[model samples]
Structures are given as C-alpha cells and as structure tokens.
Target: MSKSVNRVQKALEDLKLDATIQHMPESTRTAEDAATACKCSVGQIVKSMIFEGAETGKLKLLLVSGKHTVDLEQAAEVFGEPLIRADPKRVRSETGFAIGGVAPLGHLSATDTWMDTALLDHDLVWAAAGAPNAVFSLPPQELKDATASRIFQIG
Candidate 1:
C-alpha cells in the first residue's frame, strides 16, 4: 500500500473500526467516479471537504453526501462566520492528504467536523482512504462515531 493508504488504514485501526480500505484500479477522484467504481448510489459516497474559517483561518471538515452540494449560506450561519473552500496547500498541510482524497480521519490536526444527515439514510457509505484510488465502506453511524463528526443538515 502507498503511504497515503497506510496512514488511513492505521488511523482506522487505531479507532478500532472494522472498515477495510480497498485499492481501485482507476482513480476514484470524483463522486461520480467513485460511485461507479464502488457500484453504489451517488449518495453513498462521502465527500470529505475542507473549508477555512473566514476569520479564524482554522480548517473544518465537512462530510457531505455526494448527491448534494453544501449550502454555504447555511454553513456560514451555523459556523457563525464565513467559510472559504480551503486552498490545496492548506488542505495538504492541515489534513495530510491532497484534494480529492481527504479522509474523514487521520488529519494532521484535530479539526471541527460535521457530517450530512442524509448519509444516515444509507446503511453503508464509501469514503476516500487518504488516496484518490483507495476507499473504504462502513456503516454511516460507525463512520460518524469513528470520526467524531456531528450530524448536520448540509443542504
């Protein structure tokens, strides 16, 4: 496994999760691509998005469902401040993973994270495993617990 995959696996193990990361023959960089590769509904893919606190400059993770786009206005209201889509450098430095493969766990630092409530509708959801071509499937609630994510309405 690549270092990225290893990092994610170790993190999951450390969390005592039964999820197993699987490597794909092709890049699962986008929600559509991942859905096709995993043979699951688009809504079953978790998009680990990073946003910067407009004033604080701290990173926040948003585990959104692939089927919907985040409502920025609602997010700002919930955060009590504006949110900016983090730049690539900030994403890599803070999360230890590049764009398109940021996992919900194993971040370089502890970040405030929220998960879309819509994910709860699915029994299993797929998340990036610290690499674009690697992913893991786990129960949505289990993932929420493992990542310490607060469930929220994203869109």
Candidate 2:
C-alpha cells in the first residue's frame, strides 16, 4: 500500500475501529466526487474540514455534512468565536494533506475536532483515506468513537 493508505490504516487500527476501507479509482477529494464515487447521497459524505481559530491560535476540525455549506456565521455564533477557513498551505502543513482530502483524525498535529450532528443521522459515511483517490465507508458512530470527536452543530 502507499504511504497515505498505510497511515490511514494504521490510524484506524490505533483507534480500534473495525472498519474496512473501500478504495475507488476515482478521486473522492470533493463532496460531489465522493458522493458520486460512493453511490450515496452527498450528505452521507463526511467533510473533514479544517479551520484556524484566531482566538486560540490553533487548528480546528469541523466534520460537517457534505451537502451543507460551512456556515461561518452560524459557527461563530455557536462557538462564541470566529472560525477562519484554513489555507491549502496551512492545511497541508498541519494535516499532511491538501484541502479537499484532509481526514478528520490522524493529522500530524493536534486539532480540536467536532463531528456534525447530521453525520449521526446516517448509518454510515464516507471519508477520505488521506488521498483524493482514496476513501473509506464506516459507521458514523464508529468514526465518532474512534476519533473521540465532539458532537456539535457548529455549521
């Protein structure tokens, strides 16, 4: 397996998540692409988004529903602070992947991660496996349990 796949596999094992990764030939870098590739609703794809917290000066992860836009104002209002979209350079520097393919956990650095409530509504969801052309489908609760992510409606 490639380095990205290996890392993702290791991450899943380390987290004790008994989920199988379903790799596809097409790129799952974007929500639209992932939805098409996985043959699922757009909302069934987990958007592992990153943001830079100006107040805390740290990286943040917002696992939002694929179909919903990341509402910055709603996020700010709920979190009581502004959440700035991270640049590609910053995201790659922190997460070891480009913007469209960053995963929720297994990041090189510590990031405050929050899973969307919409994800919990789904039986399973698709997430990037470190690369654009890679993906994994697993139970939503399994992901939340494995990642230890906070349940939030921040977006």
Candidate 3:
C-alpha cells in the first residue's frame, strides 16, 4: 500500500473504526466517480473539501454530500471568516494528502472540521482514503464522530 493510503488505514485503526479501505481500479477522485465505483447513490459519497480562512490562514475541512455544493457565503458565516480555496501545495503539506484524496481524519495538522447535515441522511457513506483510487465506507454518524466535526447545513 502507498504511504498515503497506509496513513488513512492507520487512522481508521487508531479510531477503532471497523471500516476497510478498498482500492478500486477506477479513480474515486470525484464524488460521481466514487458513487459509481462504490455502487451507491451519489448522496452517499462524502466530498472532503478543504478551505483556508482568508485572514488566519487556518484550514477548515468540510465533509459535504455528493449531491450538494457548499454555499460559500453561508460557510464563511459559520466559519467566522472569509474563506478561500487552499492552495494544493499547502493542502498536501498540511493534510498529508492531495486534493483528490483528502480524508476526513489523519491530517498532519489538526483542522477545524464541519459536516453537511445532508450526509446524515444516508446510513452509510463512502469517503476517499488518502488516494485517488482508495476509499472506505462507514456510518455517517461514525464519520462525524471520528472527525469531531460540527454538524451544519453548509452544503
């Protein structure tokens, strides 16, 4: 396994989560692709979006459902600052994963995390496992707990 995928697997084990990481031959980089690969509804795919606080440069992680796009204005309000897309280099440096495979947990640094309430609509959801072709499934609530994410309707 690649170091990126191993980090995610170790994170799952550290969290005591029973989820298993799967490496698909096809890319699971996009929400649509992940849903198709996992054979699930689009809504069941978790999109891990990273945004930077414009002022503080702090990173925020948003776990949004595949079916929805985050409202930046509302997200900024909830985040208490204007947000900007984090540079891919900064994202990888801080989170230890690239854009297409940023996982909800096991970041190189702690990040403020929030989850879309829409994700809770599904009993289980698939999230990227630190590689473009790697993913794992777990209960949405377990995900919320594992990431210590604040629940919100940001998406």
lDDT of 2 at 143: 87
lDDT value for candidate 3? 0.92
- What is the C-alpha lDDT profile of model 2 across 1-155, one tens digit per residue? 66666778789888877766677888888899999999999999999988887687678888888987777867766555788878789888878777876877677877788888899889889898887877888899988877778888743
In candidate 1, stretches whose alpha carbon ends up further than 4 angstroms from where it belongs are none
Worst ten in a row by lDDT for model 1: 71-80
**Candidates 1 and 2: which is better by lDDT?**
1
Counting clashing residue pairs in each candidate, in order, gives 0, 0, 0
Q: What lDDT does model 1 reach?
A: 0.90
CA deviation > 4 Å runs, candidate 2 = none
lDDT of 3 by residue, 1-155 (tens): 87888999999999999999999999998899999999999999999999998889899999999998877777567778888899999999999999999999889889999998999998899999999999999999999999999988853
lDDT of each: 0.90, 0.82, 0.92
Tens digits of per-residue lDDT for model 1 on 1-155?
A: 76777888999999899989998889899999999999999999999999998889888899989998977777677776788889999789878999998998888789999899999999999999998899999999998998889888854
Comparing 2 with 3 on lDDT, the higher-scoring candidate is: 3
So what's the TM-score on candidate 2? Answer: 0.91
TM-score of each prediction: 0.96, 0.91, 0.96
